[model samples]
Target: MLDEKLLSRALLDDDKENLMKRLLLVCVLGLTPLLISGCQSAYYSAMEKVGVHKRDILVDRVEDTRDAQDEAQEQFVNALEQFRSVVNFDGGDLEAAYNKLQKEYDRSEAAANEVREHIEKVEHVAQALFDEWEDELEQYTSQGLRRESARALADTKSRYKQLRASLTRAESRMQPVLSALLDNTLYLKHNLNARAIGSLKGEFAGIKADIDRLVIDMQRSIKESDQFIKAMQH
Candidate 1:
């Protein structure tokens, strides 16, 4: 009986251990998104400690920002096409058409947000790299090396200023597009008829112009991003 009791207790303990392991695994899985989202600064600092500095991060983030902008441009183009289609609707369930346009607007907004987030990441890393470079200049023992480093830092700052200006202009362009999209979506949500479509038509030209300007700005920003990344690589 004593031996049986011990055996039963051991099995119970084993089961409890397994249950705890499973619960821990479940907790980790549930927290995955939070872990991924938390503390970019910590991640950057940890990477820096391991020799992966901010310059490398800046290059990666610039590319990411460029890609995000490209995606946003594509999404906006798609939304524009959808808007055109809705404006041309002859005889369909106007509510359904409005719903489709609304979905496109939502998608465009999400893409624009992604572009902004990538740009912010690029800015964050670039600022860190520039600040670190500037601070390290005082630490240089050799005057000649210090002067050379300072020159490089100044040149990088100039190029970065240009790049950041382009990026910010592109970001600013997104607002008009989003506003137009929201206006059209909201108008259609309420109207859902020929009059609503006609009303949107009057605004289409303005929306198109805004999109065209946005595209141009995004293209310029992308070019600047490529140039900056190439410069950082060297």
Candidate 2:
């Protein structure tokens, strides 16, 4: 009636102001986490400079990695059991079976990711420790002490090589199991009928074989982790 154009312009301006405020808030919130992460990393770096050292960090990370791998092994076993159950599923609520499989798959995925992350953490600290040791060798004034330190570093590296190989092998074994899991999960998701049970039957043998292999690999990795931890403790 009166000044409709002026009223619309005012409303548009108000909306823009609110939108800008929201965007500003979102950016600040997002940056806060990144800022905190940077601060934590800086703190660790500072601690290392003060003689806390990456060797200590490596030991902690290795223990964490070992525990994570153990947990992952349990999770994968549970997922395999669930997979076996679905394949042997008789006439029952198809939805329930699908849900269980989905849950197990999600859990397995999370556990596997945790294991991989822990391994990366261990590797990061280990590399930093080794590099620092090598660099510090030149700073040694006494020839006898320098030689001793060099020998210790070489021995540690050799042991780490074996441990890393075992851990990596265990990590690599997860892919086949995960792939098998995804295949069955997707198949069930698409065909949520009784036939979905039958569809998974053909995959059981291969999955069983994969799980058996995974279990063995994980066991070997765990043993390696224990030995490495013992070596570090000594």
Candidate 3:
């Protein structure tokens, strides 16, 4: 009886070992692929949340901002044209017209400032991209990155000069005609002479010529800026 019991125990031990081995193999075969697939799915989902598709959602917002900027520029140009038609401030209605001019100046200043802020934001983001792009990968932001940067600076200067010129012109228009007017003035507000207007116009002509040169230089700088920015981003 003892011998019989020993043989039965040995057979039972063998069956247990085989069952465990089969269970382990089944687990490895079934679980390995599932584990890998789960990891892959999670990685893709995370990327989708923070990747290019997420960024593209802002495309409309960017477009809207650009559209608003264009409208502001149009309004500013119209206001400038209107200024050209004005008879100097001596028309005895000085207060109203002067106030209106001031308001337009404020409006233009606001719009220009908005554009500057937008550009600043773009620059800031471009800079941030360097962590990933410049070190390891390449990123695309603008073709004229270098140009935009240089132009941004130049545009800032140009806008400032234009604002200053506009302010001076506003003051000149308000000046009592007798204070600066001699004769042959193109603009007349009542008995005021027009010589001072011609003189002012000449000064502005020179300033405009300078502005044109600055603009050309800025344009050239923009291309170089684009290349530089691309290099840095990449």
RMSD of each: 11.9, 14.1, 25.7
- What's the lDDT for all of these models? 0.79, 0.77, 0.37
Off by over 4 Å in 2: 1-41, 49-51
The candidate scoring highest on lDDT is 1
Model 1 backbone overlap count? 0
* Model 2 accuracy (lDDT, Cα): 0.77
- Tens-place lDDT digits, model 3, residues 1-234: 211222233334443455443433343233575663344323223323323221221222233334444544454554443344333334455445444545555565565455444433333333333333233322335657755555554543454344334323332322122122212122333323345344444444333343344334333333333433333334
Give lDDT for model 3.
Answer: 0.37
Error of 2 at 10 (Å): 56
- Residues 1-234 of candidate 1: C-alpha lDDT, one tens digit per residue: 211222233334443455443433332233574663454455555444434567766776787889889999999999999999998899969898888899999999999998887777677678878888899998989999999999999999999999999999999999989998998899889887788888989988999999999999999999999998899889
- Return the lDDT, model 3, position 96: 50
lDDT per residue for candidate 2 within 1-234, as digits (tens), equals: 111222232334443455443433343233575663344344345444334455666776777778888888899889988888888877778788889999999999998998887787678668877887899999999999999999999999999999999999999999889988999999998998767777788888898898889889999999998899899889
Ranking by lDDT: 1, 2, 3
lDDT of 1 at 31: 50
* Highest-TM-score candidate: 1
